[model samples]
Target: MKFSACLAALFGAVFVFLPAAAAPVDAGHARVELISERDAALPGETVYAALKMDLDDGWHVYWLNAGDAGLPPQVIAQPSSDIKAGAIGDIVWPLPHLLPVVEGEIMDYGYNHQVVFPFPITIPEDAMGPVTLDVVADYLICEDTCVPEQARVKLKLETDQAEANIREGELIGKWIAKSHVPFPGEARVLKKDLNWSLSLRLDGGFGKVRSIRFFPFGHDILHPAAQPVELGRHGATVSLSAADMTDVSKPLDGVVVIEQEDGARTGYEISAVEGPPLPDTSGLGPVGGVGIQVAAWKLILLAILGGLILNLMPCVLPVLSMKAFGMVSAVSSGHAGEVRRHGIWYTAGVLVSFGVLAAIIVALRAATGPITLGFQLQNAPVVAILALVMFAVGLWLMGMFELGTSLQNLGSGLADRDGDAGAFFTGVLAAVVGSPCVGPFLGAALGAVMGHSAPVVFTFFLAMGFGLALPFLVLSFVPNLYKLLPRPGKWMDTLKQFFAFPMFLTAAWLAKVLGDLAGSGAVAWTAAGAVAIAFAAWLWQREARLPRILAAVTLALTLFGVTERAMAPAPAIGASSAYAAKYEAEPWSASQVQSLIAEGRPIFIDFTASWCATCQVNKATTLKSKAVHDFFAANDVAFLVADFTRKDPAIAAELARHQRAGVPMYLWYPAGSDEPQVLPEILNQGLVTSLPVNP
Candidate 1:
């Protein structure tokens, strides 16, 4: 019996003393191992452990939220006998790089080459001997194809005699340090109609933040695309498009990554409170809020003042002659009440026109991204309609048709009733023609309104409309102002005839706007339409049935044909000689600007349009001056002209970036400074020459 027992004990001793095999047995595309920071640990102490993975070339593992596609790696740790681990802390992940998946279809955030995920292990006081732990790791490695991989890694940590492995501990320490720190501020999510606005209230703003990007922690919260981040002095707000699958009740967690112009990056983890009440978006609060209500009020005041100044611009001046004629005729006819009524009707016309314009802008902005003032004129069809209207108005003033008279007296006399209707239509005409002019102080106010909420934008427009009507409104109400006008006589006829020339000139200018939009083909059609309308007017003046019938038919056919051609897609600038000479500029692109900035070149960006009277004036008077041209050439400035004559979202965004509602926006970027110095709306030779030249 003793010999048999000795034989059993000898076999057991042999098996117990044999060396155990160390695991992390390699998988196909990745090598994952369970590693302990310390060789040993004392009882009742915490130890750090990591599941380290090294992937083969061209293979990557997903982040916690795999964005559009893929799955994240998983780790499950099991303790051996007599080894107790409290709970494994959450895995600490390093910052992930963005990976384009599916080539232009989807994007995924992930890591390649290597990743170390550190987890905590707890040892109970009663623990004895070596501590053994097993980690089961499952991960998907992806390149052209994805491969599901699993590895069982075992780690033995001696607890009886604690010993530290400095190298391994430092590696774990490095990974732990790479984890994202929590954002130091109050962050809340505010719902704005169909989208979400994330507001981060930092104490002192994001200093020198060139760009900010956000990554959500899960699906069904944010769109898997980038959003525009509007920065303020105190913080930043990012416009986030919500996914249809988002659960509004749940909180949002994400990372706010900021990159400097010099390419340095910093990241912070943020937890945003969901379901907050919508905040006030009126006035200037939407323009970077910053808790300053006064600033918004100031912007509104500026908008009103800007509108008052707009009437002085050359674009609106010609229309005022019609208003003056209506007032003089009413006073001479001994209808004093009609003057005030005309003013009221005209004011109403201006206000209603502005309201409709604002509503259209708001709707378009919601559907598309940023668009600018005079955006409607960018459409060739719209320009064509406006041109026809201008031509008809000119012809009417030239005695082609009589107002309020019988059709039989078509070309003989003016309207017999009060000119209130004419005054109202004139106001509407003024607003339409005045849209392309961005006068002094108007650019800043409108730019701020454009970047703000819908309510604020509309309010600013109303205020400006009021300012525009103020001058005429006062003139009608005050008898002293009207008495100064010359009495109605033969001179009135001469003056009226002379005014027709200006109307014709204005129509000719709109023809240029149409030409820029649709090329020479559209211009030719416009010229034909003009000829047809003039001939039809002459035929109508004959007071014969056959001529009038033929006139109506000719007018209808001309408009229908012109409308069809005007609505077609504009010919490419390179393919159109008229457009080539009209602009004479290189196409402006966002990427090209960035590339030039990267090369540290001084840049001069001129945001202009063919229809904008202010833009044309600045170009002819200041930009084309010999002194300004010479200075630009000597300074090695890259003269880039962004023609807003056509609708371009990129140019609109650039204008918004510089706080300009419309053109004649002149920007000067000195070498070594990314921030541009905006020149005045009305430029002079001194303004161009005074700019500092880079050595």
Candidate 2:
């Protein structure tokens, strides 16, 4: 018996000396282990433990606050019946690295290669010795794509006062030491306009710092935007753009990371006050890392190109048709000086209109929220006025009445030779009506600088307006192109009459737009006002003082009545898409998108508005086709429409993120990927079908 007792004691001592560890559970992309620092712990003692994840190369897992996408690693823990529940405190999250999930597109905060999460196991003071804990860890592992994985492991701790090994305890200490320390000095966060800056005043100076970055503990931070870092003596500020952060009333929580010249980095955790005088950031030159500055020149060029494309839009096409006739007439009239002068006047008109529009948009955005392109047309009054102008122009072209002055020349067959005012007004109308067609190239450009300075906004807008007038301005200057026009003859009358139909068509289209904007009541009122206008026109042709006076009164009454009725605000409603019903597309919602993505389903989002002619054309063709529908059905792709027909700040913010001015943004979120793929503004069935659903 004595010999057996001695043998049992020896075996117990040997087992206690061995490190307590759970077997590593394979999780496809990673291996997870629940390990303890020592084999045992006495009553009132705390044993160090960690959940270790050994990730495959190039793969990563998210931190508590994932920057743009993915969720943090979570442990599935049940109450330990054997151990006190309060003994286990909240999980400690170590500082994670900021990863560029997609370079220059998406960024996230996460851990890569290997990460250790410390879990301090406290032994209850009341006679407890051995404790068993179950840990089932779930995490999203990502590289080019994301995969949700899980690993389950059981860790056992024996109770003993004397343990031979303390190596695992020392190792856990090192991992815990790697966590971001609390900021030693004052911290502040300031939100100026749409831009946000988080400043840190550290105890240690910034002299040896190589680069600095702020990893915000929230996803509202615009990850892809340029974060210009400004560093001072012991201070640094990271400037960034944020969306949907209506309340900056709470203190900002984030980790501030700084790299050294030796490639090593340190992180400091902090809570920042909302209001601030701001720390000094003028001590040193710009640091080299992370965000790349957006190019203003590139945006201006893109805006010009996009504006040039607007000439092809239906709303602007009829106006261009009239200008084509004007150019031909100017050439036939043989006025070289006047031709060049008209071109200059027309360009001046376009630039002036664009400037006014830019100023209005800037003001509205400052007062309200995110905005760009076609917002003017949201006012039913504007649509009604445009309709009235088109109808009046159609009547004039049909030989209703002709005026001899500069004002009349503005409507004559030849804009350039008729009068400079005519050419200028023509340019103004072209720009005003063309504002709705925010096509590609311009989307990204405007998006890059939308929340910027007033001067910058005007510059890009003027460049775009210049592009819109480029075609006609060139014809006005180039004598050779003028020669391409047929000589003025009796056919000019017939051609002029034919052009009236297109003007009428534009008028009808504007009426339809008004109906959509303010309901059918606006359309009925506009139609009634049109009849009054036509009667007034006929009365004016009678050439009597009383008749002219009556005509003027009727016209004024019609205009006043239309303006009053059209300006009435419409009831709020969801954006309806004709194509959505036909294609079985769902209305877009951020929560739905996240849910579908988590389910590993492919999603295709169409950012469209009814006022957008290009968006309607695409829907009438590519998105409406049976082939596109079949592809979606076959691949289990969820079709969603982000309708921008009405004012929606959420949609505006989303569009701004993609650098788009307005609707017709096609976003393809493939299965197993969080980052969406931006398809061209114009989509084809073949391209839609060819998108890969897997990595």
The models' CA-based lDDT, in order, is: 0.73, 0.74
Name the runs in model 1 displaced over 4 angstroms: 1-211, 214-294, 407-418, 451-453, 542-550, 574-586
lDDT of 2 by residue, 262-349 (tens): 8777888888886653434322224542111466677688778888898888778988877666665555567787677777877888
Error of 1 at 398 (Å): 0.9
lDDT tens readout by residue for model 1, 1-695: 99999999999986443322265568999888777788777987887888888889998998887778888887766555344334456778776678876432467888999889888877667776776776678888899888888988787767776677777788999888777789987677765433566767677777666677777897744334435555543566665756775787777788877777676667789988864422221122123323233356777788789889889888888788877777777778766687788888889888888888889877755434345788878888778878887787788778886536553256644454336667879889888878778899887667677546677778878888888888989988898897787788987777776778778888788898888889789989988998899888888777578997998999999899898999887876631233224544445544455556656778777788888898888878877788877887787766777778886644564566566668878888886566678888988888888887562
Worst 10 residues of 2 by lDDT: 283-292
Top candidate by TM-score:
1
* CA RMSD of each candidate after superposition: 11.2, 10.5
Q: Candidate 2's error at 658, in angstroms?
A: 1.1
Worst 10 residues of 1 by lDDT: 277-286
TM-score of each: 0.66, 0.62
